[model samples]
Target chain A: MAELWELSAAALRAAIGRGEVSCHEVAQAHLDRCAALDPRVRAFVTLTPGTALAQADHWDAARARGEALPPLAGIPIALKDNFCTRGIRTTCSSKILGDWQPPYDATATRLVREAGCVLLGKTNLDEFAMGSSTENSGLFTTRNPWDLDRVPGGSSGGSAAAVAACMSPLATGSDTGGSIRQPAALCGVVGMKPTYGRVSRYGLVAFASSLDQIGPFARSVEDAALLLQALAVPDPLDSTSLPVEAPDYRAALTGDVRGLRIGVPREYFAEGVHETVRTAVRRALDLFCDLGATVEETSTPHAEYGLACYYIIAPAEASSNLARYDGVRYGIRADNARDVIGMFEETRDLGFGDEVKHRIMLGTYALSAGYYDAYYDKALRVRTLVKQDFERCWERYDVLVAPTSPEVAFRIGEKAGDPLAMKLSDICTIPVNMAGNCAISLPCGFQDGLPIGLQIIGKSLDEATVLRAAHAYEQAANWQPRVPSLSP
Target chain B: MPRLTLAEVEHVALLSRLRLTETEKQKLADDLNVILQQFDRLQAVDTREVPPTAHAMTLTNVFRADTARPSLPRAELLHGAPEARDEFFVVPRVVDTE
Candidate 1:
């Protein structure tokens, strides 16, 4: 049998159910792993060991009393710090929010807690989840579990690294651009972004509201599906939350994709992607073909504009949403401000990081009187064409298969100081956010000892097919997930 | 798209409710210019017929039933406030009486 921390969330739940393992044992094993491994991985921003053990004890008592348990009762899960946990310090890896314990739980956080999952606590992210690399984190940067020198990817880096290192079997992450998928790819774990509106976003620290969707990160496609099943429920609190019922995602992992129509978007293979990463994705396509799924080359021409469009759209939304964080409300305030206007200016200037200010400035400029049509409006129009590109593919395809990222994890600070270069890292995965479609990334193969991700993208609200296809490929490929070897 | 001047950079900062140092303004001007120059490609693409997408998915006004319900206790909500006094948040004076 694998080590206790190495078991999947599904397995951990079953173990607790069967009395083969106490919920306490499972919680302790994972918490111990986090304690041992987190010094190097830096995956967690806050860890609640006492609360975790208390939850485990409650579940163990319920089990001893013969009470039926929630499906995810004893599973340990990490949350991206951006998700508000009622009393937990939910920093989005930013100094702007100073030890803020939100008043209410984010809908997703509430659902996960209700599902009886033991909390492994909040993990780090790029401040406000604005950058592709965790290097933008105002808090400590989370290192890739595969190689400590490399980044784990961001703004969900800590969540990805946590799951990849087995500190926790599952984690919650939010993806505005490639936050979840890119990090999962770099860390050799399975990460998924549900379609916009598929998951409720109420109480999530707003970054790019329209593009942000909560997701799951796990070691396997099945584990990711399990976490998403618990998270993808609708919420009235969030007006944009889909009113439709969620499909049974765990049951969707049927390990078969017979006759499934897979479209290979040619633009995803542009010269911007590293050859080795593209090659690995191509090999995964062949494996899918062998599973009886048909693959055909297609085009999403406007997807090339995704990064540029995303920069405008995301920042524009960010600037507006972030304005709520004034000194008078929650978060920190600047001292020595003489007037209200001075307070707002000084508070934001003092609290926000350089990247946050940069985006805010860019966003403010785009939305300013004269430049509105030139920048924001034009980007929105470009966004429409990008969405149409996916719409066209969906007319004839069940799913789109592509590389999740242009390259594998790079050494920390490799793209630091070069904002454009860092932004370009999200090239492959950003298009899906622009299209508001569901997508999942799983390890297809390795490049130079780092994992390469093969993204299975489904149309909006079509996560069932996405999970089915990724599960089919994962099972067929049977690639063993790797954990980093920490050596002195 | 034209490069942003340092003055325009300062204007943008003020609009964003942020204060930038002189060095920061000069730096932001250069950064924004380089970044915006890349976006200049959009102007060439004729989007005359393209409608903008503010929200990606189809959405309708979501109306909730009108009812009085308990809100989060003000104490819990205001716990993180920089300054609070007697059920109200305290801020620097918004208007001048002098």
Candidate 2:
């Protein structure tokens, strides 16, 4: 019998269809794994064990009764706490929301539930997905599965850590900048950030709503693609969600990369990138070239401006999005207040973390009356150039390639004091979000025993190409077999 | 480069609605100064004629249908409130006499 957790979603569905393994047994095995590993890692905030088991039993009975099931039948998936799960405490990893239980599921969460994905639990995140290291999680910092002391890259760190540790085969992650990809890279798992608006953000707590996107973190490119397929339905509740037919993302993996034009931005190879990361990226590129794809050098002139522009825009949007969390509406409220403003101040002051406050303040400054033209408006203009640069390249190349992060995962608290260094860590991934394109971070290779990711970026709604290219590279490199030995 | 004073840091924090401790205020002032020094570097670029972009690459007007929708039910929506009277969440009033 196939070990339940080791089987891919495709294989699991097949086994369930063939009656080799019942959905209940598979889910139970995953739950058992979660029980075994989650305590040390602190990957989850809530595990609805009964709900997951009941859902699996429902699927199992349906299968036993000759009922046709959905594509993701019996697949166990975890959700980032930011994606509200009805009746589950969706804290977004902040004390403000510590006791808040969302009454309605986010659009994507509901869709995943309807697809028969067993909800294992809600994973931890950076308070409001603001920080890079899961260390910023207000509840508990999730440790990297590869090395316990190290961080699993944040906001989506818990999701990445859980998937990497085999606590769950798949999990939902939201990326604004590199939240999904960076952590996935650090954790040695597959993280996909679909083109902005490709997945519904209806249920996702607002974090720079313009750039925030829902994607997947999984053990493999194919598994990530499967999660995307299930989650990509256009949600009407999210006005920004694009109305388009979801692609057969898994099927797109069949085609070869022959004649495909892959561009390596000349600027990406320059200053500040670590040597090992560059080497891993080059090796991945070499693998693509060996697969008959043509590798060419290109430049996005405004790429260097991505970080500065992102800092302004993301914080500005975040400030606006987070303004909803006033003392009254939702989340924690101060016990006693002399006045409404005092209550607001007390609630928010106690609720948000330092980084969150810093961004909100910076954003508020940028959008302030005198500074709007000099900052936010100027950043928007720079944003135009960056997008144009991507368009020009895509017109010539099928996809763009680069190292997902500048370096391998730094130890937890390494850059905590130096916010600028932490901000620069997201340099490469930020531009993709700015341009609203899709990107994937796959385990290219490792640096000093820690994994590095090679990024494959695609045009908008072009998740198939992103997945295809990453899948091809994953297969060519066979990085799947090199899963970190976590049993020790 | 703009040097942020302790008072300026306090003002910014006030605008940000954060109640910073004395140490936090001191630390943020220094950090903000360094951050501003970096922002000053961007001034070298002659963006006099450049238009700032908020959304860089993809198509705009990624829209959904404009239709009336029912509001969230009163009770369920406000379930997490720490203090509430009737359907409304109660808080101290914002505008007040000092």
Candidate 3:
């Protein structure tokens, strides 16, 4: 059973193609795994076994007719609840949107369906993708597959945990502030946040529009590249989607790390990082050095200010994006309202979680007339300094490598009381989003029996280089044995 | 560091349209105080000459041609609305008129 679950997505695709395993068998096997394990993990908000089997049947029929099938034929993938899927309840794990079934599919979701992938179901998330831990989710908090008590780092916690637990080979995740990579690091899986605008945000329920990017979560770097291939098409539906040539990222994984200049950000290691996590990052860097890569200590001087800028900018945008949920247009509505304002007041207060409401209020204040210059405007200026810091580093190195998070997965309720500590977890990560660069997090080593992730970030649209470095490191380390002690 | 007064927190909550009870307002004041103190660290950085950038890439003149496209059926637009009248979303008066 473990052997079957451990197969890479590429190998699984080959097997399904050769009739070695039928599409129905693949779908049923994953369903069975989810059924047996998901209760303990709580990774999925909704499991659509019926829809999955139907999609699998369509793939099987296409193959039987000897017709050309898509590249990802019959592969099971979990959809993050934030991505809008037509006819399916696309909740962002907020009670306000608990019943909203979007009539449109996000451009990325549509492209994935067109590629013949089976949509397993929508995974859980932090409400509005705001919190670092899934505890902020209105529905269920996703547990790290490695340890039931520990959190799968969130907003994309369920997506990372689903792939980590073998509930699915690949899943989609969106990262605004370490949503994808932090969770992937905690769950011992591969998660990529493509360069901003590389993937479409057309139907993704916006958290921070300027910062949010949709990407793939997978068991291996190559598998992530395959899913990235399926989702990277430019779409007119998203005005922010980049119109650059979509490169063949899968072919770029040459698995050779020789002469690649890897930058170790000096400020990232200065302090606040856990000793165990630092050791793991240092070991990964040493391995890169042994693999013929030149490791250099680089500095993103203004990185210390990232958390400040990200909080202001992300929440400000979130304040605007979430303004649509005034209760009259869609989803949950306050039935007992005496007036429109009452309806909005009652609906949002009851529907949004504490963290979501906190952000909304903070953002509204930040963007308010009196504070805009001091908070939001100044944060934007600091954001420019942070981006320039990265630009200077990119001119000297190929990619920047750092620990994805300062610490391993903490207990579920550990930092739930202190939101500042929660915000600090993304300190090393928020800069990438603010800089609008590409980054991938892959398992590097284990510390105290939990997995640690080494993050590789590249200049804008340098996902191929990031993937190559990660793939080479993953192959050399072969650290797949460190799957967290997660039981279904 | 910017200090958030209780009155300011109340005003912000009103702007965000969240009707907070007195107890909730007190709790938010405490939370917002800690968050705002963290922002004080940013004042230490010298960004005096740095130009603010909202986007990383240089994109310009992104306007699409002003050609009118087929519109969504007005009936369908109101299909998901909680309350609709005559193929339009029905709402209480937002701006009071004499």
Candidate 4:
């Protein structure tokens, strides 16, 4: 029999529902796994054992009384530290908010809690989700479960690692630009970022208002769909939250891909992509072709401009959103400041990491009096061009397939000092966010002991089709994602 | 080629409400110039006829009833503040008392 911690979310939920396993037992197994494994992975920033046990016992008692349970009841999950979990300290992994507890829960947090998902812990991320590697975490870097020396691609690195290592069966992540998918690809799990405004961002600490989205990390496509179903409801808290009903994500995972149109964008296969990654994605496409899904090479000409447009727009929005962190409120305060201006400057300088500072500076320059039209405005227009490229593709194809990241995870400090190289790590994943569409990354192949991610993109608000294609691929490929301990 | 000078870097830092050391100014200027060269590529692409999109999804004013609703308790709201007294946030003086 499989250990409680090793069971898939669907299996565990059924076991708990059938009274074969108590929710308490399931929650305890995950907590014990975290206690044993977290010292090596550093995935969790804070573990909520008391709350998890209480919630588990609550579900167990309700089941004993023969009451109907909510979907995803009693499954242990990890929340990225950027989410505001009321009473749990939500550090966006920055020194400024190191111990500051949020007064309210992010809508996604509230919905998952309402669904009875046990809280395993809050996972680490890059400071304010600014970098591609977890090395940017002000608390500590979360290592790749596959290779401890390598990064679990970030800014949602800890969530990806936690799910990969069985620390949690499901975890939530936010993608500004490939924060979820890139890490999931590197860690050999499934990560999906829903269409923009698909998930409410009420209490979510914003990185880039236009590009940021909350998503899920699971080991299987079915599990990703289940978790997303719990999180995809519209909320009045976020005005940008889509007002329409969320399509039934889990029910749509029929795993039948007959006649599904899969488009392989040409630019995603161009130079700079590792041969192994390209080969893995192409093979995944071939597998789709065999499964009766048609595959064709298409062109999205503006994808190369995504990096430049993203850097400009994301930072500009980040600079504005992060301005609220000034010392007058809930964050760290600098001592020995003579005035409010000095206080603000000193506290921010002391609080933010180098990456955060760099972005803030870039944004400040771009939004300044003389440079707004040249930098911020130009990026916005180019952003339209990037979106139009995808719009054109959607007119012809139901889904676009590519390698989630150009390369697999790199060593922790390999690109830490070189900004450009680090930024390039997310080149393949950033374009989807630029267009405000939906994308999912799943393990397609392995290279030298590291797993490769194949990305499937869908039209805006069409996560159902994306999951269907990925589910078909996962079922046909018959690949069981490898746990770190099983790795060669 | 230097795109952003040290003085410009410092000015940008001031606008960002962050203070940088002399060494930081030097390093950030170099980093900013590197990043700016990429942004400059946008100049080559003609966007004269393109209208900017602030969001990916089409959104309109979301209206909820104007009825009064219970809010978070004042004490609880103030609890997360760095320093608070009598339900008010404490901060450095804003006025010139000299």
Off by over 4 Å in 1: none
Per-residue lDDT, model 1, residue A409, is 91
Model 2: CA > 4 A from native = B56-69, B93-98
Candidates 1 onward: DockQ, in order? 0.86, 0.57, 0.64, 0.82
lDDT of 3 by residue, A1-488 (tens): 34555677898898987788878888888999899899999999999999999999998998999988899998999999999998788889999985777877889899999998898899999998988778999998998888889999988999999999999999999999899999999999999999998999998999998899999999999999999999998777787888887789888899899999999998888689998899889999999999999999988889999998998999899888888988877777777787788888888888898998899998999999978988998998999999999999988899999999999999999997786998888988999999899999999888777889899999999899999999999999998575554544
Residue B68's C-alpha lDDT in candidate 4? 94
Question: Candidate 1 vs candidate 3: which has greater TM-score?
Answer: 1
Docking class of 4: high
In order, candidate lDDTs are 0.91, 0.85, 0.89, 0.91
Chain A TM-score, structure 3: 0.98
Q: Which pairs of residues have clashing backbones in candidate 1? A: none
lDDT of 2 by residue, A246-339 (tens): 9799899974888889999977877999888898898888889999999998999888888888888888898888887777777888777687
- In model 4, which runs have C-alpha deviations exceeding 4 angstroms? A486-488
Q: How is the predicted docking of candidate 1 categorized under the CAPRI scheme?
A: high
Model 1 Cα lDDT, one tens digit per residue, A1-488: 78999899888878888899998999999999999999999999999998899999999999999999998998999999999999889888888789888999999998998899999889999999988768888888998888899999988999999999999999999999999999999899999999999999999989999999999999988889888999989899999999989988888989889999999999999998999998999999898889999999999998888889998999999999999877887889998899999999998988889999999999999999999999999999999999999999999999999999899998998887776889988999999999899999999888778888889899999999999999989888988646666554
How far residue A143's Cα lies from its native spot in candidate 1, in Å, is: 0.6
TM-score of 1: 0.99
**Chain A alone, TM-score for each of the models?**
0.99, 0.98, 0.98, 0.99
Worst 10-residue lDDT window, candidate 3 chain A: A479-488
lDDT of residue A406 for candidate 1: 93
lDDT of 1 at A383: 91
